[model samples]
Each structure stands twice: as C-alpha cells, then as structure tokens.
Target: MRSAALSCPFALTRLFSLLAHDQQLRAYMPAQVLLNESVERVGELDVPLCGQLPNDWSTWGFVVNGIVTTIFVCLGIVGNLYHVRTLGKHSNSRLTRYLRVLCIWDVTLLTCTFGFYGFVVISTGYKPWYGDITYLYMVFYPLCQVSWTGSMFVVTAISAERYLAIARPFRKLLSEARSVTKICLLLLVAVMLINLPTFFELTQVSCYDEETNREERMIWLSSLRLNKTYMLIYRIIIYPLTVNFIPFITIVFLTIKTISVRRSAISRSQNTQSLSPSLPAKQDSGTTAVLTALIVKFLLCYSMPTILYVFEYSENEELNSRLIDISNFLIVFHSATNWLIFWRWNVNKSSRSLTQSFIFTKEEAARLTYLWANTRPTEVGRDLLYTLIRANRSLALIFANNPPNQTAVKQPRDNATTNGHLCDCRLSESSRSPACEHNIQLLAKVDSHGVIVGIFCDRIIQRLSSKLEQQAIIDEIRALGRIHYSNRVPMRNTDWMLAKQYLIAKLVKDECDIDAEDIRIVNKFASFLIHEVKCGRTCAIAAEASVAYGFYPSSAYTHA
Candidate 1:
C-alpha cells in the first residue's frame, strides 16, 4: 500500500538536507520546517525525474509513478526474460543472434528498473544499500542508460540488416555466422561507450538525513555534468542523436524501403517460377513478418517519448515531469506487451517437442486457420493456391488418359494414374523419385489445366455475396479438404476430425466459394503427401510454396 513517490527518497532527503543547513532553519526547531514558504534546490540536481509537482497531484502521482509503473515494469522484466529463453532455444543463426541480443538488453533494462522502483523503493521506503550508495552509484541509473542505448541501436541495426539483405542479398556483412557475431559485439561495445558518460554524471555528497537523524551520503550532480561544453556535446547533441533521432530515422527509412523492395522481390519470384519451375520457390528473404510487426510496435510506442526529447521540451517543471512520467509508462508498456506480439504471431514456429504442440484439436485448428486467414491472406493463401494449381495440372493429365465422363473416385484401369487418387500412387512407394516426369511431360497440356485456377479465384469473389449456395459450396470444400488430408494420413481416426476444424476457418475467408477451398484442400493434401511419403516434414514448406510438386525429385523436396 506504499506510495511510489517515496521511491525518490534520495532526491527528497538531499533536498531537505540542504534546507536543514540554511541560515533561516537554525532559527527554530520543527516549527521552522513548516514556516518555510519555499525550498529551492541549493546545488546541482540529482535525478531528472525527481522534482516538485502541485499539491493537487498526490493521488495522480501515486497511481502513475508508484503502482501502475511498478506493475508494468515487473511485467516487462518477466516478458523479456521469457523472450530471451525462447530465442535461446533456437539454432544460432544470424537472425536468431540479433534477436537474442535485443532480448538480453531489454531484460537488463526492465530488471534493473524493477529492482530499483518496484521492489527496493516501494518495500523499504529507500534504496537497497545504506547511505543511498546503490541507487546513486550502482545499479538502476547506469544499467538503464546502457541498456536503453543498446536497445535503440540494436533495433536500427536489425532494420538495416533486413533492408540490406532484401535490397542486396549478395551482401556478405550480415549473411555469415562470424560476421553477425562481430556485428553484435561491435553493437554492444559501441552502445556501452555511448552511455559511458552517464556513470560520471552523478556523485555522492554528505547531507543530513531527517529520518535517520544523522549525516548521510546522498546523490548530487557531479562537476562533469555542470561543464557547458560537455553538456552541449553530450546531452544536446550526442544523447538526442544516439538515443532517439538517429535510430528512429534509420528504422523508418529502412522499413519503408524494405516494403517497397519486398513487393518487387515477390514479383521477381513469380517471374522466376514461371520461367523455371525447377528452382525452389520463395527462398529465405532474410526477414520475417514478426520482425516487421515488432518494428511497427516500436514506432508506435517510442514516438511520443522521442518526439518530446527533440522538438517538444517545456520549461515548466510540473508539466515536463508529467510528460516524462507518461513517456516512461509508454516504454514499460512497450516492453511488457511485446511478448504478446511474439507468442501470438509466432507460436507455430517453435520447433520444440512435438508432443507439446502436435496435439491439434478442432478448436486449435480453427484458431490457427483463422489467424492464417486474417494475417496472411496473400502470403499463405497464395502458397495454398500455387500448390493446387500445380495439383490441377497433374490431375488434368491423369484424367486426359481416362475415358470421358469418368469420375475421379472411380478406377479407370487404363493408366498408372488410378491406383487410388490423383496423388495416391505418388504418395506410395512407386513414383517417389525422378517423379514420373519423363512420361508426364509428354501428356501435359498446360492450356487444359489453366482455367482451373480461375475457377478457384471466382469462389473468393463469392464471399461478399449473400447467396445461400455459397455456404453449401463452402461446406463441400471443408468436406473435401477433410477427405483429401485424411486420404494421405493412413486413415487415423483423428485425422478427419482435425481436418474438419481448420476447414471452418478457411471457409469464412472465402471470396469465391468452392475453388478456393478446393485449392487449399489440394495444397494440404499435397503437403501431407510429402510428409507421409518419406520426403520429411521440411518439404511441406516447399510443397506449399511451389507448384509442380510432382515434377521435383524426392531429393529436392528433402532439401526444401
């Protein structure tokens, strides 16, 4: 139930100690403490955040500076800790290394702050060590400066890396393991050096402690901070640039350029896919949607604080203090909520134990599908569409060999196509490698299967209409996807149930009714076939991204 304002006891005791030494204070006892109309700061300032506010601000300060801040900073500490642990589990790639560094410093920042404010100050009404030594010279102030500097620059570095890789994939700087390690080390050391001056800015000075009733050491601004030239070079120029402006501008520019470059990259990939379907589709692009979303979050959370530092400074003490408090809250909130962003968007990516994640139920599938539908319509949906178009191509060739008016489920008994389904023979042992491509190439009529993709596109358009048939069409797609996926799963009892749940989500996103679902069903069936047919699980990604899955050899899918 303690107020957060008490956390500034170092600043408060210093201020009142100066008053106790004043010539007017020697005139009386306890009465003189109240008789004084105003108390002015005698010497150098201790902390920027500690200062006076109006008498009416007590309740507001307690809620903001004390309780809410403590809670959020505590949350931030936990979030960053978990983030570090999670990222640490992944293999040491260039991207994962950068992410790990970002998480480590974020933990350092949040933990130090929480220790200082959330625990020490609120619990004991003072700093952790006697004479205010720890608060003044040790933990929170110094760590926060270096950690913050590290976070800002790390983000900028990551942005630059992503943009560079996309804009110039051949660049060797961030591509190699050793180079990434070197960059991470240089970034850490450079940030520490940038904030090195903060340690010398404050020093301990002797002052009378009213509560202890004796002389005690308290924090005060050091002579170095008072130097005019150092202030200009340090706070006015270097601090603003290193802390906010430089990183902010660089990230913004890089993010915009990245978006532009990525659009062109996708276009280039499409052209490449058409010209040479032999190539693996959509190779690693050196960036992820998760990082993009994180960058967006950083922009949203840090703008007000960074803006206030540069263009919006106010001379009024109370107003300025309030603004700083709000900015601090914004920062802590940013650190806390990023975990939600990470786990929400990226839960599927963890390569942890399959037993933990593979228990996919109907509800879980629905949720996963819904997320895919909403967040990645173009990326995920297009991936599904490509495979189906490829499947339709293969399916058309098989049916061409059959007599007219023959159903897909019925055995034609004329060619190798009808052992089970379009992909059944392929998923079995016979056509596993070299992919029957030598024979299929002679029968492939690209024009005959071309219209199938357009028919799928029409179903996506029907999503906007109110026709009752659309639902029925959607239901059929779900039913087919279930059967299609189950067809490759060796007839497990749970396969049908698992497939049905995800179908509900895919159906809801329909613009066209049947073809979209059919496309997704075929893609799912094809990808599943890859897993069951001994190509391994990694090939599922390639099967989803590329068409002509049957054209590639088993070795290609395994590498994919």
Candidate 2:
C-alpha cells in the first residue's frame, strides 16, 4: 500500500511538468501559427479587439454605434452652426468670443474625429483599411488628436475665464474680445504642434493567417519598438495627464470655485446694502449659469468614460463594447447640449422685460449713466427707456409734442413778481379771475444747470379744494412734471439754458391763454433771467478765485 501511494505522487508531478512545457512551447510559437490557432479558439477566447477598444467589434455592433454617432454628428453640426451664427452677431462680448471659439472646436471635432470615425465604421465595418491610407493616417490621424485635445483645452480655458470673471472681475486677464480670440488661436496651434508625433509614430503592418489564407491590416506604432519609453510617456503620461486628467481637474476646481465665489458675492452684496445704500449691487449674468450647467453636464457625461480609460483592464468584450458606445455617445452629446444651452441663454437674455433692467428707475438710470458714460447706449438702456414711456402715457405725449430744437411758448402774467410765485398771477392787468389765479400756481423746479427737474401746482390749491380734488390735482401735476422732465433733452450748459427758456415760454402759453406779443415778452424775460444766472455764477467763481489768491474782490476791481 505504501509503494502504491509514492507512485501516485510521482505521476501527479510528471503531469504538472508536461503541462508547463506545453505552455512554454505555445508561448515561443511563430505569430502566424498562433494567429491560425487563435482563429480556431476565437469562440473560447472571445472576439478580437481593435487597438484601445474595450470589446471585439462586429458588423452589427459597428452599425449600431455608427447610427448613434451619426445622429449626434448631424445634430452637432446643425446646432453648432447655428450657435456660431448667433454668437457671431453679438461677438462684441468677451464671453461670446470664447463661446464662438468653443463652437468652432466642436464643429471641427465632430467633422474630423467623431464624424470620420462614424463614417468609416458605418461604411467599412471598422476595417483596418479605413486607416491604412498613408495621408489619412499620417496627417488626418494626427489632426484628429489635435482637435480632440484642443477641445479639452478650450473647455478648460472657458472654465478659467468664468472663474476669473466671477472671482476677480476687476482683473483684466482674458476679458477683452480680441484677447480671447488670440488665445483660442494660440491654443489651436499649440495643440496641433503637440500632436505632431502621431504622424511619426504610426505605421501600417499586415497580419496574415496561413491556415485561412487571409490577410488583415493593422496600425502599428513604430515608437513602441523604437522607443518604448516614448510610447509609455505618450500613451500613459502625456495623453491622459496633460490632455485629459489635468483639464478635467482644472474644470472641476474652477467650476466649484466659481460657484463659491458667486455665492459669497451675493451674500456680501446683500450685507453691503444694509451697510451702504449707495453701493451698487453686483448683478448676475446668465452666461455664468449656462457655463456652469455645461461644465456639470460635461463632467457627468465624461467622468465614467475617463475613469474606465484610466483604469482600463481586460473584461467581457460585449459589456466593454456597450460601455464604449455609451461613452462615445456621451462625448458627442456634449456638442448637442452646448448649442441648446447657449440658445436658451440667448433667448432668456433677449426676452428680459424692461422692468428687469437697471435703467428703469431714476436711481438706476443715474447709475447706468455713470457706469456707461464713455460707452454708447446699450440695448438695456433702450429697452428701459421704451418701457418707461410705454408705462406712462403722459411721458410719451411729452416726447411726441416736443421735437428736437423746437419749443412751444406761453404768456406770463404782466405783473409777476421776481420770486415767481403762482399766487402773483391774480395781480395781472386783466379782470380778477379765479382761473388765472389757479393757473399761476404752476411751479417749476430747476437744477443747478437750469434744467427743469420738477414741476407742480402750489399747495394753496389743496387748501382751497376737498381731499379728493386735491389728490386728483396732485396726481395730474405729478404726471405733467414727469412728462416734462422726460422730454428734456440732454445738452451742454449753453444749449440747455436756451432750451429751458423756450420750455418755460411754452409752458406759460399752454397754461394761460395769451396774445403772441405777451408770449414774446415772457420768452425775453426767461432769456434775461438765464443771462443773469450765468453772470451771477461767473461772478461767484471770480470772487472765490480772488479770495484764494489772497486778493479781495474790491482790491481786484481797484487794480483793474
């Protein structure tokens, strides 16, 4: 029994050694023989995988991927074209300029890379011949990488720009339209130069199966044999780190930073309002929201694929193929979604009501005037003005009645006092009339530059009438004043003085029925008052200058 047990152990050891020897023999066999054998073992080992492909692609699989990719390509092309045109119309803004470049990148990527791949798979069933053409592989392949990497770089740049705009708005950086365009062009050139190695590293090789008497083409990278280190660096380090990982991290970091900064700014603005009422609050733009949404969507769509790529390993070919298809679809989906986001953003911006504008109220108008003093009137300003006039019919009427350089005139009471009180109209040479006395109650409030800022009837009318009548008169006068103020044109001091005189003459004639000679007299008096005001201001300035120079006005006059 002991001798039989020893023999069994020896037999088991011999069997194991034979199995090891067979494995070694198989490993050293010629590649062609191995290929023939692999074809027979295809069912057991799973289908053959293309370079960097997760699964063995079949005709039907290619067809499906092609169909999905073609859909995205068509949509992407159409949407990006529209985006380019629409953004081009408003290319004055730095953000729009960046977006235009992004759209261009998307179009190029779809046409050169994704679209090309889809065409080849749909037409040729993923055959190696698709890439076997010398120029196609040498030039177009490298260009494809360039476009892909360029697109990632552009997304990174957009994130950076948005972060800076939100976190450090005062810094100039890429705020200018021309600067953004230049940067985009520079990035394109840099990406193209970076991907030039693709042309040199790639070459076509033939794989023959002697048993089946068939030949297949394959893309072989010479760099893998010529310089293994470069292959490792290019595939593992440069492609993933510089082209994918770095940009991904940067986009995520910047997007988070932007969100935090925006929130902080909003909170600070709210607090500032309580502390300093005069400080203008920072307004939010839809562009930031659109960018944020785009970044988030990009992350959601690409994060899984990127992770799979980084940690890629052998797996079930079918599952991997499906995953790859989904990943490719997500990447293409980005182009489609970007156009939609931009379109929605533009529509929302253009459709904003005048009430939402900063130039609607007097305070807002003043603020806008101060901020945009050096710039031309913007759409916001025009919309705000339109809304104001539309809301107040009286204001519109004033604009309609007062044409540029033309003024209506009315006669003033002959016996009006220098103080110009509305009560003085009762002392006119005409018979005592209550209507004349009531008409004299119109008061005009002028600013330092003699522009009529306000007008109203005297409070004596309120005392003479019931509360309801008083309210009605007050409302009427308020409307009239607002209309008059809205009609006043923006002009220089001299022009404004003349305009004010003419406006006052018109007011007198409209309020009180008077002859043409009386209207002329009132106009002359208004002109005389304007001259007197100008002389008084000039004298006051001269007196102050004399005092500052240590010479009294009387002493200066004596010297003269």
Candidate 3:
C-alpha cells in the first residue's frame, strides 16, 4: 500500500477535486485509475433520512400536511372551547345551550381522530400511541367517524329545532333540553357504531427500509378486503358526503327557514302599537343573530370541501389531484376565519360579562369586543353585520310576535285615555278590484312640521331633521362613541364623530365650500343620522337651520 501511494501519477489534490465533483462515481473508480482502492463507496449504500431529513422543500407534502393538521386542531379546539365556556355562563336555557357542548365534542373528536391520527404516522414514521387495538378500535377510529357523522346529524337536529320553533309554534316540547340532549347523544352513538367499520380496517404496523429515518406514507398495500372497503367508505362515501354534503345542505335549509319565519313574525306584529321591548325580544334577537352568522359561515366555508371531495372521489385523477390540493388549502382558511367570526359578530357586553363570570376569561375573547367595535367597515365586517342584524330581527319577530292571551285581558281602567280613532274602511285601488278593510285604523292627527321635514327630502336643511325620527338615537350615539374610543380616534377626519362635526361646521359657519353635491351629501348624511343617531332635539335644530337655508349648489362640493 505504501509503494502504490508513491507510484500514483495524479496528486492527492487532483483526486480530491474529482471526488468532490462526482461523489457518486468515487466508489466505482477502477483499480487502474487509483492506486489505493480501500475508500468506502458513496453510491454503494443508500442514504436514509439520517442523511438530511429530506430538507424543508423536498418534504413539503409531509411538512405542509403536518403543519395544517396541527393548526386546524389547535384552532378548532380553541373555538369550540370558547363556545362551550361562553354558553355555560350565559345560557339560561339548558336545551339551547347544549349545542355548544355538542359542537365542542364533535370538534374534539375531529382534532383527535382526523387531525391527530392522520398526521401522526406521517410525521413520526410510527403508528400513533393510541393506534393499538384498544384505542384505535375501541376509542379513536370509531369515535372519529361517528363524531364526524354526528356533526351532520347535529346540523339536521338544529334544523329540526328551527322548523319546530317556526313551522309548528305549538311544539315547544320539541325544543326542550332533555329531549334534545337524549336525541343528540343517541344519534351520536348510532353514528359512531355505524362508522365502526373504519376501526375494523385500520392496523398498527412497522416496516424497515434503506430510508428508515424518512417519514412514511399511509400506503394502502395490504391485500386485506376490509382495508380496501374501509378506504372506499372513508374516501368515497361517508367522509365526503357526511362531513361535506349533508351539513352544507342542512345549514342552507335552516338559514332559509329561519329567514322566512322571521319575515312572517315581523308581519304579524305590524298591527301592534306599543313598543314594550320585551326581554324575550332582546335575548332571542341576540342569540339568533349569532346562530345565523355561525351557520352561514359553516355553510359557505365547508361546502367547497364537501363538493370537492365528492368530485375527487368520483374519478378524473388529474382533476382529483387539483381539487384535493385546493380543498386542503381552503380548510386552513376555514379554520382561521372562525377566530374572526367570534371576534367580530359575537361581542355583546352582556355575553362577555356572562362568559367572564361563568367561564374563565379568555384573552382572545376579552379583546374580541374591542377588536370588533374598532374594526372599520372592511372585508367581512359589513356583510357579517348586515346578516347578523337581519337574523336577530327575524328572531325577535318569531318569539316576540306571539299573540297575548285573550283571557288575560282586563277591563279598561277608569283613568285610561284613548285617542280619537277611525273606523276600518275599504278602499278600491281600481274599480275592478275587491276591497279589503284595515283591521285597525288611525285618525288623522295634527302633524308636526318637524315630522314633515324628516319624512320628505327637502334637499337642504330640512333633511337634517330626519335624525329625530330614529327609534334609538341614544343607543346609536353610544355605539358610535364606543367605536371611536376603542380606536383611540386614529384620525379626527376619518373618525365618525369628527366627520360629523366637520359636516355640521360647514353648514353652521358658512366658511366652507357648499355645492349641490355637498347638499346631497348633507342630505344623505342627515338621512343616515336620522336612522343612526339618538338626538331628537339636535335633529330638530339641524332640520330648522337646513330648511331655513335650503341647500348649497351641488357644484360647490368637491370630492375628497
């Protein structure tokens, strides 16, 4: 060996360069080319994950899926937990509040079964600790598929509750907590048992390869018939349809019914005059809004994946691949957006206080009200707010619109004062049409000039009085103030208060550019304030000033 080293023609430096350039070829270097042949061959042996853990980019499949599973599980757990805690504190009706607990249970199963088990083996190259016969068969797998199906069943249950509460108003027993709880639990158990086939097919196993350190994929190589059947049921039938389709359709149906019931309820109340503003009205209104927001979001976000899964399972491998990728990505967006939904639409001070007293205060929740109030009318805000308000108003009409017991009517008190009333009369729209009499009528009373100004568009100062017509100007002002304070009045010009001030100043000082468009802006702003503000006196003054001055020419106003 020593003599061969001396006889080598090429220097050690040259050998190193060749080896560096072509490490793979170093092992195969012929005896003729190199004097010494004892160097261990690089290409002769395969490298395992020990070589590099596949680097971050190469194992994107594992890394992405693993990370997604972790994040989704975390968020789902956190959100469901928050709901449970909040419900425990604020829920007066045990039956209605049970849904929160059920939702948490379902999401917990999802995190454990779908999120945890699915990602664990891929991440660690071993069956999850609970994949043994006891956990997998007895607990995890069965619970996962069952809970998943139960989630759909729960949605259907919620729909049924709505249908009963709306379509069959007499069926109060149907919405009772005991009945709902028994039904939910029984249905959940049935769903789980039905899906137990999933557990029967899964098996814990170990394998060896050159790349022993690399993460393993769930290769469906076993020849067992049950395994294949399980795969079919999971990938094609149950998971796709139950997780995606059933819930989506159920939510859509519930939303429509809920809306329709609301409209009907509101119409029935049109004849009533006194605004007692019952507690049932307020609580129902708030809860209904939250529920609708939650349902709509569930419908919109979850539908795509369900539809995509259906498409993926049906065939078209190329299409399936693309759809799967898109579906996976969308799931992340779906999970993350829940945090936003809770923060934005579900922030009532009463609810917050209830949550604080009953459930431990959550930092995320504490900041939620502030975050929501301070949020500008940007993406998702306006749409969410409109949907919530509409939903709550409908709920108000449904429960609050119930007819008062005729038997409870007492004789008129001696001191009762009745205003002049008009008899019901029929008016023909045209000579040919059948006429209908109004059930109740109002006598023509002296009209306030202020009411006239608020009612019609005078195009000038008259428009300013419209704010007086709003039912709850004080509440609106407080809400606006809350928003302003929450945001620290980031900019005076941009702030709602400051903006209103500037508009008012331009009208009062006469040191401002006033145009026809300015008058229109003023009119619109006046109209909005009429609905939005709580100040009748302020509205009256503004209206008087505006009617006196009329309006500035449209050309005088310039776009900011």
Candidate 4:
C-alpha cells in the first residue's frame, strides 16, 4: 500500500479522505459517491436530521411548558363546558348569556391550539411527519384567531353594554337576548373579516437551503404586505389594547366606582338589604374585585409575550429560542387561565342568581334610571364602580390612621358562623375560603321572578310619576279623563314588558271579580309605595350625598 501510494501521490491524497483498505474504501466510496452524485440522492439519505437533534421537551424547560399548558387547557375545557351547559339549562339571562358565549369561544380556541396542537407536538417531538402546514392553516390558525378575536369582541360588547346600562339608566331599550345575539353575530362577522387575510397568507412551505442540497425541514411562513400596518393596528392596538384592554380598563374603573358607591350606600342606608343567604348583596363588592383581578391577570398573561413577539418579528436575527418557546406557550396558557380566573374570581351561585335577576331586567334599568334621575343635573354622570373604589380607599386610609381604641374591645366578627355560633373576626366554616354562602342564602329567599316583574313596574311607574308629578297629578288624570280612552289592543309579548296597561291587566287576572276602579286605586297606592318606600329615602339620601351609594332594601318585602 505504501509503494502504490508513493507511486501516485494524488491517489494517496484521495485515499486519505477514505479508508486505506479496499474493504474500508468500498464502504466509504459508496457513501461519498452517493453524496456527490446528485442533490436528489443527498436528500434521500437515510441519515436522520431532525431525529439526531436532542429532545427539546424532555429537558426541564419544555417539560414545564407542556405540563402547565396541559393542566390549564384541561381545566379551561372542563370549566367552559360547564358554563355553556349552565347557560343552556337555565332560562336565558343577558349577562349570563354574554359571559357563557364568551367562555365557549375561549374554550374552542384553547382546545384547538393548546389541547390538540400541543398534544401533537409534545407526543411527536422532533418527528418529521408531525408538522404539516395544511393542518396548521385549515385547523390551527383559523380556530385560534377566530376564538381570540371573537373573545375580544365579546369583552368589548360586554363593556359597551354595561356602559349603556350605566349611562342611559332609565331607557327601556333592547331586550338582553336580542342585544346579546346581535353582538355575537357582530363578533363572528368581525372575526371572519379580520382573519380573512390569514387564510390567504397562511399556506405552509418547506424551508430549503438550496446551497446545502438537502431537504428543507422547517415550515416557511408568509404574510401579505397589503395593509400590514392596518392588520398590526387591529392585532396590537385595536384588538388587544382597544377591544380587550380598554374594555377591561373601563370595567376596572367602573368596578372601583361601584365599590365606593356601595360602601357609601351601606354607610348611609338605615335598612341595608341583606343578600339572600345564598346571594351577594344587590350592590355587591365582589363583582368589582373579580373584574379587577380578571383584567389585571389577562393583561399580564398576554402583554409580555406579545411584546416579545413584536420584538422577535421586528428584527431579522435569530431570537433566543427560549423566548420563542415561551411566547408560543403564553398564547395557549392565556386561554386556559381565562376560564380558571373568571370562575375563581367571580363565581358563586348567589352572584350568578343576582347577575341573572337584575342584569338587563326592567327593575335594574329602573333602578339605574332612578339613580340617574336622582343625580343632580349640575353634575356629570360617572361609573358607580370608580366612585366606589375611591370611597373604599379613602375609608381604608381613614380607619388605618385612626387606630381603634387600644381597649381589648372584641373585633367585630366579619365571618358568619354555622350552628348559630359567633367567633372573633374569623369566617364561619361555610363562609371561609370562598365567600359565596351568604349570596346563596339570599337567592333562596327571593322570588326572583316576581322581583323581576316589580322591578319593571317600578321603573315604568317612576318614569310616569316623574312626568306626572312635574305637571300636577290631577291635571294628568284630567287629561286622561278627557281623552276618548278606547280599549287599546294588547301588544304581543306584553308578558315580557310590564307596561301600565299590562300591569292593570295582570292585576285583574290576579284579583278576579275585583272592580276596575278598586284596582286603579290599588295601582295608584302601589305606585306611591314604590316612590315613597322603595325609592323616596334613596332619592333623598342620594340627592344629599355628593357620592355614589348602593342601597339594598330588606329581602323580605312581598311583591305588591
């Protein structure tokens, strides 16, 4: 071999690249020839490219991502499914309906992106056949985008609805069901339109390095240049910041005000209505607490990841791979967290009942109207929650500074007890951990249905009374007397609307054979009671106080 190598140094040079022995040369020669022969042969090489790479998830970092996201996704799916079922099983409530649908949208998104996609990726790590573009575009991106965008719209709609309720106060506007349906339809359309560009631009292409002459393995992403600026606006500014963040902020403001108002009302009112043992008080503070927690947590979940993604895409260099993984994980993680946080922060049977009982109800609107009417014309209306929070903070500071007398006066027990027992400041067994027991008890006592009716009636009467009182009541009656009051045709769904005519009709139905004249007198007297007993004190106190208040009357009052 040395003699032959000396004879041809060029051959020896070539031999160094391979083994010297014929048997060894044959083994190396085939592979070398195969590699050099054509790009096609190189591409077809049996050697594993992706397989040779270390398992990413098996490492501590990816494993944590997998576990946490999996747990969150599972919980979210279960929680949202329960909420949807609850909505379907119960009679429709405007607030409940809105929240229910929102939850469902979130769940669907989570299932696709987190549950399905995540499962596939985790199970088949570094596997070649695992990541296909067709599946990503048709199934993953659309589903995720739709859910996310729809959720944003839903949040916005909820805020807008609340704003209308708070601002208008007295208007007998659209039905909750109708309004919610319309909003949902709008959400669908908006999401569809926003994601339209995604469908066109989301095709998967295999990334190839032509110079290397090997099969490209990674997925190639392409986005349309047209109106990218606008799309960014929608995704970054409008969708996240405007649609989600703004509404969330508005709710927070409102929630704080509401808290302050309720506290003020509680302090001022002599007879505070106790929530049904099972229900939250009418002007419950928990609602604000929950809303605030939700907004804060949601912003935290999405904010950093979104910022990272923006930075990642803005530059052309390879980002820290860890950051990429983290950002991706955050997207799915948020979906899971939304469900858990919502339930955790704002859940109790009583709160649910209260939400159903008043949100979009005629009574609620009337109360809101009464609040507005009571509000001095000189002052601008504000979110009740915002005022409530300010009041609470002020009170907290006042109490904190004025340390109670150092005398061993027993701390007033904040917690209620079971077995008719009382303890020092500690919550009773039932009321410990979750503060839902009191609300539950309250819901049980109230005839939520009749309450709804009276609420609607009170609003109508208040409006009529305000108008009638503005002009002399006698004059108004005389005007009615002079008119040829022909029997009016009853409107359809008069059941839903508690109009004056409908109320009289209902009175007749209840008190069979009672003279219409007596019924009229009773109605007038009832109206007086609502004005005097139900709202008179409230109006007086509200007019006097330049602050927000929540007035909860006794729950034991019979529906008149």
Model 2 scores worst on lDDT over the 10 consecutive residues at 1-10
Q: What is the C-alpha lDDT of each candidate?
A: 0.50, 0.49, 0.39, 0.42
Candidate 3 lDDT at 323 equals 41
* Stretches of candidate 1 exceeding 4 Å from the true structure: 1-57, 124-138, 172-174, 209-213, 267-287, 347-560
- How well is each residue in 1-560 modelled by candidate 2, as lDDT tens digits? 00100111000111112224545323322222222244323324432222222234465556555777788788988999988887767334666777888888888767764433566666655533312432344445555566677778888888998888777653432133567878988898878777767657555554443334445444443534235456456655676677667888999999999999988877754522321221112124455667888889878876865665455323443555455556556777786568888887773343332112211233432432333333222322232233332232222223333443343212223434312222232122353344434333232211111122211112312232244453343334334333333444332343434444433343343444545544443343333223333333433444555567665464211111
Clashes of each: 9, 7, 16, 31
Q: Tens-digit lDDT track for model 1 on 230-293? A: 7667766787777778888889999999989988877754522321221122123323566788
lDDT per residue (tens digit) for residues 1-560 in model 4: 11111111001112222223444333322122222233333444542221122233345334644566567778778888877776445445455677787788878777765533456445554212213422543456555656766765676566555444444422312233445787688778877886665455333433333445455443222344123454445444564554345545665665555456645655654232221211234334555455556555555655654454233232221233344445546655665666665566544453333323322234433433443343322112111111221222221121122343442222334444321111111222343334334333322222232244344334434544353343333233223222211212111221112222333344444444656454444344333322223222323333323123332322211111
Candidate 4 local Cα displacement, residue 200, angstroms: 2.7
Query: What global local distance difference test value does model 1 have?
Result: 0.50
* Candidate whose lDDT is highest: 1
Error of model 2, residue 157, in angstroms: 1.1
Worst 10 residues of 4 by lDDT: 1-10
User: lDDT of candidate 2 vs native?
Assistant: 0.49
Model 3: per-residue Cα lDDT over 200-252, one tens digit each: 54343332123343322221112331244544555456554555566677678
TM-score of each predicted structure versus truth: 0.54, 0.52, 0.44, 0.47
Off by over 4 Å in 2: 1-60, 126-140, 173-175, 207-217, 224-226, 271-285, 347-560
Identify the candidate with maximal TM-score: 1
CA RMSD (A), model 1: 15.7
